[model samples]
Target: MNSVVRETPARRELPLPDGAISYLEWGAGEPGKAPLHFAHANGFNGFTYRRILSGLSDQFHVRAWDARGHGETTLTADPARHRNWYVYRDDLIAMAEDFKQATGKKIILAGHSMGGTASVMAAAARPDLVRGIALFDPVMIPTAARIVMLMSQLLRRRGNPLADGAEKRRAVFADRQTMVDRYEGRGAFRTWPRGFLEDYVEGGTKPREDGQIELSCAPAWEAANFRAQGHNITTAARNLHVPFALVRAERGSTCRPPFPMLLKRRDPAAHVMQVPGSTHFLPMEFPDVVAKEMRGFAARLEREGR
Candidate 1:
């Protein structure tokens, strides 16, 4: 059984070039203290990771936000405009800048999977705004895999295959509990705790006027994110100069050893931990472990006076 205590985070929004991004805050966020800004994985929202984010609030002020198409944030009406994940990277950069300006200290950027990849990209592009980064099984495809994935995109002319799955996904349910009941112990959510799954269902969906709940992030957008995985993560990893900690799942990690090895070579100070018997959804399955490492990364940054 999971023993982590969860808390409700304050919801807020930040206006961006295209639309406003919704974020959740944990802790007081005292001024002059460096804040931890988090991004959620693809198809998931900031609220989905509340258990993990809330666990670290005692030591640090943390905030997590929904990407363009996830959670309460505005969706991208035109997927054509965001062919790559650079748009997500830019949004992260903007959020970091805004946090720096608001807190008068560089923010610690962190994320999982697609969110983690975007954090690495933002940190590399604008190192001044970020003091450090912690990635949780970031969507980092190896060079050979990347080439194959990109080449496979050419074979799908009937729109993105992943997107098709999203489009066919069930969006509404009888209620939140019903959704939770159906999702628990089923498919990808099998490893997720009941409380965490409930939180995800509560935050990821909204009640419609028709007396049903619907996903805030439309299927097409989630599919677009999967299809737009051609970003150059290798270059970003090479360019990252900030202190970074990467925790990968042992069994089904999106980030393999070579990528973490490359990151260690590029930044010797970087920390890497592979949790045995875990999957890519380590953040959800092991919130306490992930939060401990995040705090440790912060401690390391403070030790280095970064």
Candidate 2:
């Protein structure tokens, strides 16, 4: 017997206020299948997680959206107006509502880094529409770090190294190949698996009027995202009533010490695991592991009739 083949992800757009949200959808349009929405990290687009999402397409109706100020999303992304990550939280909530309305079913939420944090915030805000959430190394800073960041913000000081690095990132590249060459085996991308960097380069750049490819996510916007960390993720994590699973990186994790312990304390039912030898980019380094955790979490939620 010949095995059936699934279709590749379809790029689509959902109309929102002032603009549209671009997303990629995978899996057959099979009814009764739980819908899963994946959000990408800061400075990354939906297609960056294509491999992971595509793998889950067979099990769940998978969709991944490029967050505001990233990829093909047409939402307004004014750096000056970006005060905190609440904007991203609101956007994810909107997307979840849309998905719920369209499918008439509660959706599962998952994300990486910034996306993961936004997923938690959105799930907490609208648990009615979200069945559960699985996060990979969401940016839950330690208490002392948060205090220091708050102080820096109060003093109007620019002490965020991530934001500083983002501000200094090269916006324009000669071509995609140049970007691949520059990014391959370097810095944050050093641990990325094969084809992941290429996928990022393909989806993270756009053709400029000058015939050059520029970063879809502008440096200022990325820097703004990095600096806009005022959102209270602790409260969000605490507010979660549905199934929650967090896969944190062992090395250079943004979900720092005590935060994970705090999460476990707040909700002993919340699943938190640290991958051995994983970096901040856990999804890229261990896509299968992350996907397995997500699949298992969603399956448990389903079994529990969540």
Candidate 3:
């Protein structure tokens, strides 16, 4: 008898007007197997949720993607590329367009951390494409990053002091084993699971003329993300034209709850779920909880989802 080895979803890179977008899809039938589209976190790629797909395969056709400038995706030379945060949301809209064309199913949009912000905006912009929202602490901050966005550019105008700081951000190990030992000794995996640091080490670096690898996205890019995170999702929530839910983790400084509060304050019908034991990275930490909540939210949207 021959043994069959199950293969992971063969991800295809899509050519967008801006650049190539990397995404994964897993399903057994058409309509992308009852779609659920996930926008991943800041540091990791879409593959981080492979286990969730394995668990939810019976229930949903799960899909996720790497955000631009993260994972194995390419970066554009145009400084004007990231001028408006809506560009990121538009990318999701384009993906949803392609998704609808291909699967003919409504995509339930979910995102973790900063990706959550993009997901929310996209859901609001195209309610017809997105069925509902499942946000994991959508990087919901009180203020929009308008002032700091200008200041960071001003500092660049004077002098790009931190222009290449990401290049300087390197970790040295006595040896491979020593490095592994160090991370394992500490609770880094407990904090961040799914062999994600490898993506940072891999996607975050490029081959230099010398034997070293250089990170393409600068430290300034990360800083600018924090600055852009100032976009008030409260305003974004008011613009939502569809059913939505924001799932917040009970622990961690990174968790933001005000997003759901803003939704509820604007409309009392929105749903907000908070899991007691998880951290900022709830889907990766509590896949079962995430899967269950997603099913309930989706079902309620049809029946009881307010």
Candidate maximizing TM-score: 2
Tell me how far the alpha carbon of residue 264 in candidate 2 is from the true structure, in angstroms, after superposition: 2.4
Give each model's clash number.
Answer: 0, 0, 4
> lDDT per residue, candidate 3, 141-249, as tens digits?
5444345545766686542233233324444444433434455424424654534444334434545665545444444454345434334566677798777777788
- Tens-digit lDDT track of model 2 for 1-306: 111234578998888887989999886478867899999999999988877877777788888999999999999999998878988889898899988887888989999999999998998899898998888999988656777887897697767889889999999998999999999999889988658898899889999888889999999999999888678887887787877888999888888877787777756777789899999998888888887898799878878778
**TM-score of every model?**
0.93, 0.94, 0.76
Better candidate number, 1 or 2, judged by lDDT: 2
CA lDDT, candidate 3, residue 117:
82
2 versus 3: better lDDT goes to: 2
What's the CA RMSD for each of the models?
Answer: 2.0, 2.8, 5.5
Candidate 1, 1-306: lDDT as tens digits:
334655678998898767798999877555444599988888888888887777777777788998887889884546665567888898888898888887788889999999999999999999999998999999888778767766777775345555667767788888888999999998778898888898888779988999999887777777777777668888898898888999999887888657889888877887888888789888878887888888889889989888
Question: Model 3, stretches more than 4 Å misplaced?
Answer: 1-7, 75-84, 144-168, 171-190, 194-220, 229-232, 253-258, 265-269, 304-306
Better of 2 and 3 by TM-score: 2
Which candidate ranks first by lDDT, i.e. highest? 2
